[model samples]
Structure formats: structure tokens, C-alpha cells
Target: MKHILSLFLIHTFTSYCQDTTYNHFSVDAEFGLNNPIYPMTSGYDAATLNLWHVGLGFRYAVNPKFGVRLSGGYDNFRELAGTPSFSSEYYRVSLEGVANLGNIMDFKEWTKHIGLLFHMGAGYSVLNGSSIDPNHILHGIIGFTPQVRLSPRFNLYVDGSVLANIYQNYTYDLNSTRNTHGIDAYLINLSLGVQYNFGRKEHADWVVIPENNEEIQNLRKRVEKLEEMQRDDDNDGVANWLDQEPETPAGTLVDTKGRTLAPRDSDGDNIPDDLDDCPFEKGSAAMKGCPERSGSMAPNSSKEVITMIEESEVKFETDKADLSPSFQQLLKAIAKVMKDNPSYKLHIMGHADDRASEEYNMNLSRERANAARTYLIEQGVSGDRLTTEGFGETKLKNPLRTVEARAENRRVEFDVR
Candidate 1:
């Protein structure tokens, strides 16, 4: 008996140390009636219903569906009125396995307040009375408890149990020893109780934890990344993933590809149309997109004008032939020079940076030269007087592999004779 008690205590201590998120321990107190049915002396009958039965127990839930309990109880049994008068006190201590039928059967789906439990185990019992020596016996007990939740910390329950004893030596009257040697006595108990729970707010018996927590977290992260990619921080029409200039100023005109539109320069001169004195005529920075005023300076010869055109070459974006308004203004100035010097023919040479295959760059450079020539013709220069050539990367003005040098090389240079 001592070894059994020691094992029970060790198991209970270990269970108490387990980490859990909800309450798993409770204390139960009950008081009601008990009926003792056997081991009475011949010709004596005990009461059909006795009084003064009480019990106290402690329980530990291993999980939501199962647990164990330790309890001690006392019962008072007395003889019927006409039969031989006698009284006995029964005391017992038990360690029992408990099954949470409420959890196992999923009672929460229908009701949150109702629950049930089944318990069974064996224990030591002692019978004591004034007329006889104490009789020691081993007893087996089984019971069911039906409970209703009263609050987070408490429950009301009804318990019914049957206890059967083995190897009884004396009768309930203590008049003589029992005739039978094994399984000689039995008792029935019915009780009302209240259980007080301890630990976290909700007990483990009711909480259900999901199994795929990590996968759900990863999915949330992926959704956040997609939302970031789709956001347009500058409020441009284009999403960040496709916008070439994501930080383009608000209200700026942009192309379908999110590149800013060129500022208006009607005459293809460097000056913007809004600021140019002669929006329709090509001129120098000093003249504000207009012809040199009369008597302002000595007249520039055709050769000097051609030199100025060559000095202010038309620039191109890398691998692109589209003309910006500022570059178109420069081309308009060259066209005017060509019209003024009717006897002179213009040669337009285009170059590219060393960033692509030789054949590809050659084609890109030719496209750039034609782009400038087309603008000159549009500005009223005779197409027959203009010639175009591509110099692919062989005549870079600055040969260093730097951003400024590459920008300098992507240009159209002009010569007139």
C-alpha cells in the first residue's frame, strides 16, 4: 500500500510540472448518502439508506480527454429499526483514472455548459465500529460524474459510484466473521459536488489548438509581399514593378511606360517654348531661339554656323531614336542654317556607347542619325542636301566606361560642306 501511494504521488508531481496554456487541476467536495449492502451478521439487516456520507478529491487532467484523481471518503452505516441495532464507519482512500466524456464526444458543439466524466480504480478501505475490531480490506470503485459549468473557476456535479470489497473478516454488526472469503461486501454512494478549477482562465478540456500554425504564418507573409509590389508610392499610374521612373513628380505628363514627357520646345532649340523669344525659329542660347539681331555683331559665315551646329550635337538616350523636345529644337537650328546656306550639303553622323553587340549598336546608331535627319526635314530643310551615317562606338568623344562618357558618346554630330 505504501509503494502504491508513493507511485501515485510521483506521477501526480510529474504531471503538475508539464507546461500548459490552460488549467488542468481542480479540487472536488461532495456530501450525500451511502448504502452498505453486505457482510452483516446472520438475521441482521442494515438500513436501506444511511446518512452522513462525505468525500474530498483532487484531479489532474493529462489532456483534454483524460485525467487521474485521488480522493478519500467516509460513510456511516446503521441497522434498520426492527433489526439488531449496530453502526459502522467506513473510510477509504483511492487513486482513479478519469475520462472526460465531454471532450471525447465533442459536447461543446451543442452546449458549452454541460460535461461528463467516467472514473474507475482500486483502493484500501477500513471498517471500524464500537463493538468490533477494525477490519481492513481492498475495494474497487467505479463511478460517473455529470457536471454543469457555473463559472470559469467552478462547476456543479452529481456523482454515483459502487464500491465492492474483498476478503472481509467481520459482519456489519461485528457479531461474527464473514462466511465467504472474497468479494464479501458492497456499498453504493450518490453525491452532489462542486469542483473549483485552478490555473489559467480556460481549462484545457475545452480549448482546441490547430495543427498548421507555421503554414498559416507563411501564407500571410506572402500576401504582404505581393501587396508591397503592387503599391505605387509616387501615385503614378504605373505600379512600382513596371515604372521606369517611379518618383516622377506629381501631375507630370508620362508615357504608357511611365517615362516623363519631354518639356515643350517648339523650334527644336535648347530653350523651352514658354521661355524662347522666337518659338517658331531655331536660334542660339544667347539669342533665345531666334536669329541674331541686325547690327548686334559681325555676321557669322556658313562655315562658322556649321561649326556651332557640330558643337551643339543632338543627344540620344541609350539604344533609343526618339527625339526629346529639347533635341528637336537643336535640329531646327541646324535646318535653318542649311536653308540659309543653300549651296552647302549637311552630313549627319550618329554614334553609340559600347554596351551591345557590334551589329546591334551599328543598327541603333544608324536609326539615331536618321531620327535627326527626319527632324531637319520636318523643319523645312531639303532632304536631298542631308546625308546620314552610323559610327557605332568607333568615334566615342570620351572613351572611358563611365555614365557621363557613355551619355556623351550617344549623340548625332553634324558636318557641312
Candidate 2:
């Protein structure tokens, strides 16, 4: 009993420095064998294997490192007669503090599936079918329980304990000359069991968002008002808030940045030179300020308009939809042409090289096309006047596997109707 208490104390002191993140509550049931080690005996009694014990227990943890358990059990010493021991049956109850060494030793990961624990407590024991009367006794217990974690909520454990009690008599009188009924005794017990834990969530770190604050709402309103105040709805020099002639034609001269001035026409044509494609030559406003082509002013076919747009200098950054200043300038010209020819609608097809996943490339191509569409919209072209499509590495301008060919494939194609 002294050795067992010493061992428990040594382990407890050494394990005060490890991880304590163990579960807080559990229940267990056990079954095993137990036998009395008669007082002053050096070893176990040589009895048959039939004697057994069964028990159930519940534990509540105070923290990751410490817990208390209430346990009750019955011991059947069926082979009591075969051995030199008394007390054929024993029933006991104890309340113990169990020290979790896994947490205290910092071995949680390496011992993820197993743990070592120690416990000590006091209890009352009932001794039945004993001679010399006085069958009830108070006992002290110390134990070592090793557990195997079987799941998040379950564990398998094997427990061993040393118990000390005072009994009124000994069934076998070692000294016939002395009537010593009041003596110290001991029992050695072993059990196999399963334990269950409960009540913690799988993930404990996710946070929920609360309602927006009044300050955030006020800031949003202020930003919207500032955007309205600074907006230039027309490409003309004036801001929309101050502009009187908001729908002035492209390139028309304006006064103090708001009102349009009568545009000069160098030629005798009724078309203003600023709006003329052929400013120095006689022209008609209906023909884009240009004279009739091949003696007639008829609209070009969709194919010709597409070819003209395809020749324009517009490019995108690699793997991105952002346009450069030069490309933005070209887009403004394209928007002007689209607005002047209201019947002509654009079909914008974006493409990507075979350098990424098909789905990723497809999305990249779509973003590029949308970028173009958005720029045209910002430049005053109607959304209905344009359509967009993405072809990811399915159509290549040059099919050869080379850097130049890949670059050529990474482009947008234009079609008009």
C-alpha cells in the first residue's frame, strides 16, 4: 500500500506540465478478476481463474488535466477455498480523483489513441461469508488505468488497483498462540472496461456575423452621394451636375465645358467638319459626313464592319481583363462607331490559350469579353448593342504549339450584324 501511494504521488507531480485539453465528462463499465492479498503476504494467492469482478463508473473533469470519478463494484472470490484467503464475496464503492497523464506529459499526438491515468480514493467495503463476525470495513484505493481511445466519444480501458482495509479476523490463523482479529489486509484488482465522453462540438472556432452598425450605413450613403456629385454622364468636358448640353455629339466644341458651340465645316457640305469622316471633301451627314462611296451612300455589310473592328488596335494584359490606356482609347473609337451606326450590333468573342484548366480558361475568356462590353457601355454604347461569348482554347488563330501561336490565340474576335 505504501509503494502504490508513493508511485501515484510521483506520477502526479511529474505530469503537472503537459497538455490538458481532454474531454470533461465520461461513463465507463468494466469486468475483470480480483483477489485478496492476505496481510503480510509477499505475492498473490495461487487460486483458480474463476474468481471475477464487475463495475461501472462516471467521471467529471474539472479541467483538461484533472477529473473525479464515482465507481462501484462487486468481487466474487469463487476460488477463495482453494487459496489461503477468506471473504468469498466483496462489494465496494469509492470516489477517486483521476490524473490524466497524457495531457500532463505533452504526448497527445504520439499517444493519440492511448492514455495513462492514476487515481486514489477511500471507500467502504462489505465482506460476506466470513468467520469471527465484523464483516464490514473501510478501505483505501490507488489505481493505474490505461485507456485506448476507440472514437471521439468512446474508449477501452484496463484498470489495476491496490486496496487496503482492516478486518476483524483471518480465516487461516498464522499464529495459533495469539488471537489477533484486528489486522490490516490488502486486495489486488484488475478490470477491463469501456468509457464514453460527451457534449463538445466538432469545430469550436467559427464565428457568426452580427447586424450592421449605423455608422457603416451612414458611410455607404455618403459614398453614394459623392459618386453622384462627381459623375460625368456624357464624354463632353462638363460634369453631369453642371452640363446644360448633356447629349452633345462627339468632338463638338463646348463653352466653359458645358454648352455646345456651332461646329465649323471647312467644306461647303452641310455636314460639320468635326463630324465628317471626309472633312476636306464634299459630304453628307447621312454618310457620316463623307461623300457617297462608288457613287452611292449604302451601308457596309456585317462582314466589312467586323473586319474593320478586327483591325483596330485593342489588347489585354496576360491572364487578365484590365485594359491599358491605349486600348481604352481604341475602345472609345469603337463605341463612337457603334453609336453612329445604331443598326449595327457587335458580337464579341473572347479566347484563351491552352495553358490552364478548360473551365478556368473559359472563365478568363468570359471576363475578357465582359471587360470589353463594360468599357463600351461606359463610353455610351447601349448594352443591347453588344453580345459576348468565350471560347477557351477551342479556336486557335495558329494551331502550331509555340509561344507566338499561343499569344495569337489569346485574343478577342469581333463580329458585327
Candidate 3:
């Protein structure tokens, strides 16, 4: 008894000493009824049902699925009425192997509160009663316990067991001698009990260790990276993963790669290339980046040139800045007039319909004007003789929100000086 108490104390101390994911120790206490059968002298039968039976055990889990237990129990068997009455006291101590069958079979997949265990082992038992001396016996016991979890710390259980006694010296009545051989007696006990768990937040019996923890962790990292990539820090309609200029100013026009559409100035001119009449030449801003025009062409002739350029105004597809073959031909004609009047200079103005955001439309209009200027230059018109500007949707030729009206609005016209 002292040794048992010492062992219990050691287990308790160890259970509280370490922090772990799951607990590995538990203690059980139970009380119920027991019945004895066999090895009874004739005319000396014991009671059909006996009342006193109790058991206590300490368990240590080797892993989630298997463990061992040290257990002790006592039983009282009394003789039946109308017979020569006798009584016996039975005491037992055992070391049992325990299998967590519920975990092995994955009961958690179907139920959270139910569990089962199977235990079996061999032990020593002593029987003493009446005026008889104590009789020692070797016993083998097998049992099954079914349990329901009541809380994190407790489980309620019922156990049924069979103890087969070998080499018995006296009958259960304790009134006569019995065979000292194998399998001489049998005892059955039924008990209700509570198992108290110690150590850890979760018990080992209920923890399901993942088979591939590294793989799960890697997958979690990948999901986090994807979430980060999807964030749009500038709210520019472009994901961070694909945005080249993530911090572009609000309402600024951008391209598919998230770069600003504001045009560059190749020459050191104050005007951007899209609007500079002389993109590659350093010229005065007063002449629209062209060398001071030798002098102004005749006002009447400039008017005629301007009327011709306006009459041949080029229209573009919605949201498009590229010039069609027909529009290119019209630009060639205008370029010829500029050549004929060498002193004449043209100012190209671009416009757009109200189909998109202001900044987007503004960029689109500038590109249209630049396209026309490029074509005229390709036809031998000097860059310095042309100036360009964009009005976005502000100077709409047709204000009505109709397809034809919008189409008419998306055009480029010229003014001559």
C-alpha cells in the first residue's frame, strides 16, 4: 500500500511538471456489484447476487492508442438464504494493458463524447471468510469500458469484467476445500465510474495528430502569400502582384502595366511630346516649340487653310487613339496644304466623348492628336509647323448621349495661323 501511494504521488508530480499538447495520465474510481461462480462445496451455495464491489486504478498512456494501468479491487460474496450461510472477502491487484479502441477506430469522426477501452491482464487475489484461513489464488482478468466525456477533466464510464481464478484452495462459500488446478473459479463484476484526467488542455485519447504537419504548414504559407498579392495598396484597380507603379497619384491616367500615361518630353521643350509641335528640336514655347515662324501667313489664306483642315476633320473609334487608313489619307491632304503655304503653321486639337473617367479620356484625346501629328510628319510636314492639344470630353462637338453624337465627339480638327 505504501508503494502504491508512492507511485501515485510520483505520477501526480510528473503530470504537473511538464507542458504538453495532450495529457497522458488519468485516475479512475468505481463501485458496483460482483458475483462469484464455481468451486462451491455441495449444499453450500453463495448468494445469486452480491452487493459489495469497488476498484481504483492509475493509468499512463504510452501514446494515443495504447497504455497501461495499475489497479486494485475488492469484492464481498455472501451465501444464499435457506442454505448454510457463509461469506467471503476477495481482494485483487493487477497490472493491465489498455487499448484506446475508440481512438484506434476513430470514433471522433462520428461522435465527440463517446469512447471505449479494452483491458486485460493477470494478477494475484486472496479469499478469506468465515472461520477459514486466507486462500491465495492467481487470476487473469479481461474487461471493457465504455465512456462518455462529461468535461475536459472528467469522463463517465461503465466497466464489465471477468476474473478467472486458477488453483483455488477454497470454495467461494469459504466452508470447504476446492481444486488447486487451472481455471477453478470465476467472478464477474459490473461497475460505473468516473475517470479524472491530469495534465494538458486536451487528453491524449482525444488528440488527433496530423499525419503530414509540414505539408499543412506549407499550404498555409502559400495561402497567406496569395492573400498578400491580391491587395491593392493604392486602390488603382491593379493587384499588387501586377502593378508596376503601385503608388500612382489618385485620378492619374495609367496603362495596362499601371504606369502613368502623362507623356514625356524628348526635347527640353516646356510642352510634352504629345503636344509639342517640334518634339525633337529645342524651340521657343511662343512658337509652340517651333523656331519663330518666319512671319505669319496671310490671314485670308490661313483662314482658307484652316477651313480645309476642319472640313477634312478625322473621326476615331470610341476609346481608340490609332488612325485608320482613311484618316491617314486625310492627314496627307492636310499636310500637302501646309507644304504649299510654307509660312503656314497648324494647331491640332483633340476631343473625346464622355465614355470613361476624366483622366482616361484626357490621355486618349492626347494620343489621338499625337497620332494625327505623326502621320502629317510622315507625309513631309515639318514637326515645327504643327502644334497639338487635347480637350478630353470638355469640348464635345455633340453633347447628347447618343451613339452618333458620341462618335462625332471623338474627333481631331485643325486651326491654321
Candidate 4:
């Protein structure tokens, strides 16, 4: 039996390696020896010749753990003590509840492809023979089966069951006077069978192993470290671990050392704050941080720096100093240049046309120069290096010959020395 079972197992798994047959419904057919016990005459010993049965069964599972089975079969019985032989045949029907031990207990992963089932049931048996009356007897059954998976629609299993009758008799001859209904009859059957499963693909082909706790923890820690390394709290290109200036403001450019770059000039003087001697004032590196001469005899200013400042000049309403949007954009550009060049200083000179009274023009021109200076300071240039002066109707780039010339003359000029 053991050798046969081992061979069956090897053949079942090797042949059906890729198949999973743990379906919800199944049909089984089996043939085996049924040994009768507890009702033999004085001289008769149980023999194998007349102790066989063949059965067909159907099973339905509610889940992996529990199911029900209904089966019917024919059994033949023989008494060897008679002069020739007394042969009788019985028909059996049964219904049993099945419990799968492998699935319910969640066995080792490799064992998932097999199932161990236990069952118990009750039914009726009918007897027929030439010397005895045909009658029915109540019986009970208990059994266990081990199943090897083959495919989604097939399996191989062995069935071993104990069939017990509550009341029975061995007396079969009318001439012999003997009791007929006092002894209990029991039948032990062991059968090899194949079952075909129907409906619904089952997960019985392979087993899935879960990751252990330590591995899961290690993965979580690795992910956390990666997240920390990737995060840039200050939004600088450098990550937090390598960043020297962690709190550097947003949009601030940084060098390889993660330090903020010296690129901002608050006074629009083309002088970066870090290098400018007077960071709050518009000044030049040559002057060691001092404003240019205010309307002096010979203006000491660089032609290039003066050109850049002149380009930033803004026009005004006849007597107002309020700047236009275009003029504001020019001022912003000037601010950037000043921040980049820390050695430069600005000279703000206000001029006007020969239209208003001298006093009024002078005051308006001062207001215009002061307005430009205030805007530069607000934009982050140094205040001490910036000086405002008014030249009313004086230093006109265009003469008052036409309205265009007059309008051009009413302007502000900037110089960097």
C-alpha cells in the first residue's frame, strides 16, 4: 500500500505539475475491498474473494475548509462456511460532511497542493439473496481521504471508510434454526479513486510565501532614507545633507558649496551687497564706496556705466515724479546689474524743460531725482552711495525747439562712476 501510494503521488505531481484542480464541485469513482467484521459463524474467517465494492460519489464544497458528499455503491458478501457458498449482495447509499484539514490549518506552503479530508455520514443499505428476504438496514459511515492535486479539473485520492449497521443477521437458511437479527455488522473499505473537479478556477497550483518582519522593516527604513535624501526643504538645488546654508531663500542661486550667491544689489547701483563698501548706498568700487559728484564741473563717470544708467532713465509727467510700468522694469534691470557689480555707484540727476518758473522747475527736478533715488533704495541699493540733484532747465540733451524736444528734456538721467 505504501509503495503504491508513493508511486501514485509521484505520478500525480509530476504529470500535473502545472494544473490546479481544487474546484468547488467534484465527482469521484472508487473500487476497493470491503472487509466484514463482527457477524461471522464459529468456523468462518473473513476472506478476500467476496468482499469488494465499487462506488460513485459527488461532492460540493462551501469553502476550502468544509464540504458535503453523497455517494452510492454495490457490495457483495459471501459466507465460506456453507457446503458450497451463500452469496448475498447489498446496495449502499450515503451522505457525508467533509472537512479539509490542510486548508483549514494552513499547512506549509509546499503542502498546499494536497488536501486531507475527514468525513462522517449516515445512510441505508439493502440486502438481497436467494435464501433470505430482501430488506433494508440503517447504517452509518465515517472516513478520511487524502487527495493529490492534478489539474483544475482532476485529482487523485484514496478513500477509507467504516460502514456500520445498527442491526443485522448472518442466518440465511430456512432449514437451519438460528437467530437472524441481533448482531451488529460493520464493513471496512479502503479504495483508490480519481475525482474530477468542476467550475471555478482554484488557487491550488502553487504556494506564496510572505516576506518576514525583518525584511519588511529593512525595506521601510531604506525608503525613508531615500526620501530624506531627496527632500530639499529650502528649494535649493543642494539637498539638505550637503547644503551649508539650509535656510537659503527660495529662488536664491547657490554655488557648489551650497552658499547663497552674492548676486543681489538693493540700491540698483550695479554693486553686489557683499563687495560694496556701502551696501545700502549706490557707489563704485574705485571710489571705495562714495556717491558721484553732484552736477560738478567735470563729471567723473565711466562712459560704459553711465550708458547703462542712462538707459535706465525714466520720463515724467510735466510736473510729477510718479514712474511708469516700463520705467519700473528698467529700474529692476538696473537693480540686478548693481547687485552683480559691487564697486559701482550711481549719480541721479533730474532735468526739466524751460516751461515752468525757475523755482518751480528746480523743485520739480529735485522731486524727480529724489523719486528715482527712493525707487533704487526700495529696490535694495545702498542709500549712502546714491545722491540726488536737480538742474532745472539746465543740462538739456535736446533744446526746446519742438514739442518732442521739450518732452525729451523733461527726464531723469543716471550716472555710475
Candidate 5:
């Protein structure tokens, strides 16, 4: 377990630093021909083999690296020899693992959907045949399945598989016999099937809105009014009421207390743009928050990483612990950071597991949230910048667990802007 955890962390951190990838699931049904191999002594080639199979299955596209599928088929077998020889009907299950090549943009699912797929599993034929024994039919499978996405979230899979009995004995006596797993003897067939994909979606794809001149102007006017109320209209580091940096020009940054800070190059290089030995010299974050470049580079720019991060669990300590100083401090720091960075909002979604009394937990979470706001105020943060809510115990973090589960009962998390 320790080794596994380390490997998982390595893989996760590596993948996190890489580009984004997506996956999906699907189910399908199809029909195809089944040919059986008969011994020369029993009769001619096994053309009498006809297949009628109904399959129910699930597929998982693990990652761009690999994926898999599982399918169970119930089939009726018949021999097409001179006389219609009905063998037995049986259930067969197959699992296939596929490897994806380099993925293209449009064929996003193909990395998980399409690839070279190999199968290995056990199956059985249960019908009583004149010369067939139920215990003798140990089955094996192997093949390739390629998938194509016809539309977003809807995929098509076509596969060719080989299924056969492991024993060389084409003819089976009434007595039961065992066969080696890897070796193939009498079984042989080629099949083709298709499946439609479902589930995966691209919800985060941006929905764009053209610039509204009226709305922009309205927002500007609201900002002006907010400044007027403060009455520090110069927008300097010092407020008009306490102008310590009276000489400081307009457009200077102000702290929460409206105090001025020393002027320094945030993106530090020995040569500051204004008086640097080399203004154009590129440097590290230590010298300046900005990096000098041959061409213009925006500070906010980043390589987009499209991620589907599932919600995290929120756990509550004991009832009395809700009022602990540690808890208050935690909320205080969180609220302060969020208020300062208005562009990044913290989503305070409070939820509880089904074990709690709905009204009780709801009231409890609400009260705890009020405490959260008060602590933030003590940290010199504004209340209008935050919102809170309680979901009672309606949604569960894990339905499989009962009340004792940690984080299953209560939680909170943050999302990027």
C-alpha cells in the first residue's frame, strides 16, 4: 500500500503538471456470425456453427494512456451440418484492455475509445449436445476494438474478436474434461459489433458574450460612486483623511488601512526599467513579479489546464469543536484572503450526510456560518464580499457509508474564478 501510494502520487503530480485529458463511458448491442471448428473425424469444417448472442456491457476509458471494456453475452449455438444439430446455450464474459496512440483534438474520446484492444477471460457453453459435455467447454478470448466519436458524448465502437474452446478435442464425450487455459483447440470465430457512448461532457467550455457598452459604462459609474463614498478620490496609497504620503501621486496602491508602501520593481532584476543597468534584461520572480521579454507578455497569462475536479469532502469535528478558536482563525484567514482577491471567490457550499436530522444540521451549519462571518470581520474583512448557505443533509458525500464517515456529513471547498 505504501509503495502504491507513492507511485500514485508521482503519477498524479506528473499528470497534473501536464496537459488536460478527458474520459467517458458507454454501452451497446450488436449481432454477428459465429463459426466453430470441428474435428475431421467428427465431420467436415465447422460451418454448422451459428451464433445468436445478446450482450450487456460497460466500457471505461481510463485515460489517454489506456482503457478497458467488459461485456457478457448469452448465445445459442447450433450445428448446420446435414441435420440441424442444436448444441447448448451459454453465457460468456470478456474483458478487453486497449492502448491509445497520440490523440488528436477532434477525436478526443478516441484516446480512451479507440486503440489496440486485447481480450482475456473465461466463458462457458451450457447446452447438452449429443457429443458435447458442459464441463469441457472452457472458453478464451482476444481481439481488437476501435472506437470513433460521431458526436460529442456519443461514440461508435466496432470490434473484431476471436473466441474459442481451449481443448483440441473437437468432439466431446459425455464425461467432463479439463483444458489448458492459454492453448486453443476447437473454438474459432470472427465477430463485429458497435456501441454508442454516453456520459462525458464539456461543460466548462466558455460561453462568450459580446461587450455591452451600456453595461460597461454602468459598472464604471458604480465604481465611481464607491470611490466617492470613501472620499479618497485621488486613488493614492494614503487616504485624504490621513495623507502621510501627501507627495505620492494618484494611481498608487493602498492597503486595507489605506497606507502607502515603498516603490519597488515587483519583477526584480538588477536593472529596474526606470534606472536598471539593463531595463530589457529578463529575470526571475525574486527580482520582479514580471518577466522581461522580447515581445509583450501579460502577467495573467497561463497555459490553460482543462480539469474535471470532483468536489472534496468536508468534515466537522465534535459539536463543541465548531466554536474552537482554531476553527475561527481558519475561517478568518480564508475570508481575508478571498476578500483581498475579489477576482477569486470562495464557494461556501455547506452540506451534510443523510445521517443527520435535516433541520438540526441545517441550523447547526447556519449558526457555524454566522460564526465564520464574525471571525472574518475581526480580521478586518468586509461582509458584503462573502455568501453562505446550508444544504442540510440532502446530498451525501458517499451513499455507501452511514453516519460515522468523516467528511461524508459536512464540507466546504474552493473553486477558481
Candidate 6:
């Protein structure tokens, strides 16, 4: 029995090695026996036989879905009868294997699956009945077994078959001659049991694997949507890792290496504030986006800068500097900036729209500038930091041929020293 099992294992392993492919294999050892009753005689009616089969085998699961196995073992049968006190033994050794035809369920992954297995094949064996002078009975055999799998590589196996070719006869003096039959039922030596996954196992083919796609447009879109939900814009190449702005859109202006673009210095302006620079000017790099000017300018020191302007068409309503109340909030906002930056002292010099005497307009301009200055002081600005000048009708910001041009001449601006 050991020799036959050894031969089967050698063939199974050698075949697997030659293929050089991935396959599942399991080694199994099975032991089983059956008992029978013979009640033909009444004197002592109970009789039984202890028939056992023991063997080891190997199975190759070629694919996740199907497999084959070659296995065989030894069979021992002891018969006990009580009708005239008779006893005998039958010994048989068999080699059988199977081709797994198919599986009931599709097993594409490493998960729990329920399925049925159909096995059809047989074994060759040497048999003998101890009572009949003990010669050997040899025969070719055929059978089948159906099984169920509780897990991958684990199963409950069953088999039964019929035997042909050898018979034995024994005559007893106490009764008529009796002849034992040569043909036998295979299920008569049936076995049942379970199998485990055991050692040196491979990863389950059914498990799902993860994937990656480089620089895909769709993935980019998804990233954008996600960023929008988070609210970051500028899309400057800053990624989430380096990105202080969490709301950046996906695919924003990023660098060649996929990071957000460094803050742009398109004009080489020293100032980096995108919102502070004039769009049309070519600003200085060190000045932070502010362009250099050729006109006489007051230094920004202490914020109380003094400057001059020529305007003639600008006008004032009598002595009052009140802008149409509609412009009140606008004027107030300017006042707030002064309050916020206390060093910002402004000088408002008003002018007539070239329609009044220079003296009268100059007087009116001073009063108007003073009136405007009063409003800022009222809005929390320091009176000492402000001054009013009356350029009157002597200066014109634009040609006075048109009323709209005249209107441009009347304005107020902060002067810094």
C-alpha cells in the first residue's frame, strides 16, 4: 500500500514541476471501515464484518475552478458469523484516482463559495479470501464519487464501486456447500471525511488587487471636484501636502512635476501681491509690484506727504464740501483708511469749475477743502494731521470745453510726504 501511494505521489509532483505553472495541491490521508449483518441462521442470528480502507493521496487543483487527484489505500475485511461458528478474512489492496470534471459555482476569487464536485473514475486492486487456500484475485475496476467543498482546497469526499473477476468457495460438512461470489459492490467499502488547506500555500487567486493610472484626465476631474468641496482656488501648483490653500481646484496651474506653480512674478515686480499691482504698468521687482514714476513725489515717511496738483474746472457747491450724500459711504471709507493708518495725513485742495472769480473760488476752495477735512476728523481722524489748500479756479484737470471734463477737475486725493 505504501509503495503504490509513493508511486502515485511521485507522478503527481513530477507532472506539476514539468508544467512550471501555478497550481494548488493537497496531501490527504483517509481511514474508513464498514460493518454488515447476516441473519440467515436462527440459532445465532447476528453476524458482522469489519471492512476498513486506509490510504494517502494527493490532488492538484490546476485552476481555481477544477482539480484532479491520484490516491489509493489498503482494504482489510474480517467476517464473524455465529450459525455453526464460522470465521474468515478478506484482504484487498487498491489504487484509484479521479479527473475532476467540473465545479457547480464559478470561483474567480479568494472568498467563500458554495459548489459541487463531480468525480468519475476507478482503481486496480489485488484481492484474496483467507478461507479459500488464499490465491490472489486481480481485476480492473470503475466507480464515481460526488463531493462538496466548504472552503477553497477543503472538501468532504465520498466514493463507492463494484469489483469483478475473482471468486472463492468453501464446503462445510454441517450444511450444504456454499460458494462465495467474485463480484462485489464498491460502496460496500465506502469512506467519508474532510480535507484541510495545510502548509506551503499560495495566495488565493480570487482576491481583488488595486490599480493606478498615471495623470488620467478623469482622475484629475475628480480631484477638482474634491478640492471645490474643500474651497481652495488659485490652483497654484501647491499640492495638498504643501498647499496651505485647501480649496484649490484639480489641474490648476501646476508645474512640470505636478506641483502648483510658484507664485507668478510675470513682470518681475519686487512686489508679489497680485491684487496690489496696476495691470498696465511694468512694475519693479524689489518694489513689490509698484511701478516707478518720474513725477515729483512726496516720500512715504510718516505717511504725512505733501504734494501739489493743477486743476481749474473742478467746482464746489458754495462753501460746503459735502459730496452728494449718495457718495457719503465712499467718502467715509476713505476716512476709515486714514483712521486705520494714522500716519496718513491728507490735504484736500478744492477748485471751481472755471465759472467763478479766482479770489471767490480760492476762498470757496479753502472752505470746501476745510469742510471735507472736517468730515474726516469727525469720523475719528486727528485734526492736526490734515490740511486744506484752495487752488481755486486757477488750475484745470481737463479742458473746460465740456461739462463732464469740468467735473473731472473736482476731486480729493491723499498726499503723503
Using TM-score as the measure, the top candidate is 3
Task: Give the per-residue lDDT digits (tens) of candidate 2, residues 99-125.
Answer: 877667655656567778889998888
Off by over 4 Å in 6: 1-24, 35-51, 61-68, 80-97, 101-116, 140-187, 194-417
Clashes of 1: 4
Q: Write the per-residue lDDT of candidate 4 for residues 155-230, one digit (tens) a residue.
A: 7889888888755544322123344554367778888888876545553321232214357678989999988987
State, as a TM-score between 0 and 1, how close model 1 is to the true structure: 0.47
TM-scores for the candidates: 0.47, 0.39, 0.49, 0.42, 0.35, 0.33
Q: Give the 10-residue window scoring lowest on summed lDDT in candidate 3.
A: 297-306
lDDT of 4 at 391: 97
Off by over 4 Å in 5: 1-21, 38-41, 48-51, 81-84, 101-133, 167-182, 200-417
Tens-digit lDDT track of model 1 for 186-221: 889999999987654466555554223357679889
Index of the highest-lDDT prediction: 3
Between candidates 3 and 5, name the one with more favorable TM-score. 3
Assess candidate 4 and give its TM-score to the true structure: 0.42
Q: Looking at candidate 2, what is the lDDT of residue 134?
A: 33
CA displacement after TM-score superposition, residue 65 of candidate 3 (Å): 0.9
Off by over 4 Å in 3: 1-17, 210-417
Question: How much lDDT does candidate 5 score?
Answer: 0.48
Residue 41 of model 5 has an lDDT of 32
The all-Cα superposition gives candidate 5 an RMSD in Å to the true structure of 26.4
Model 2 has an lDDT value of 0.67
lDDT of 3 at 334: 68
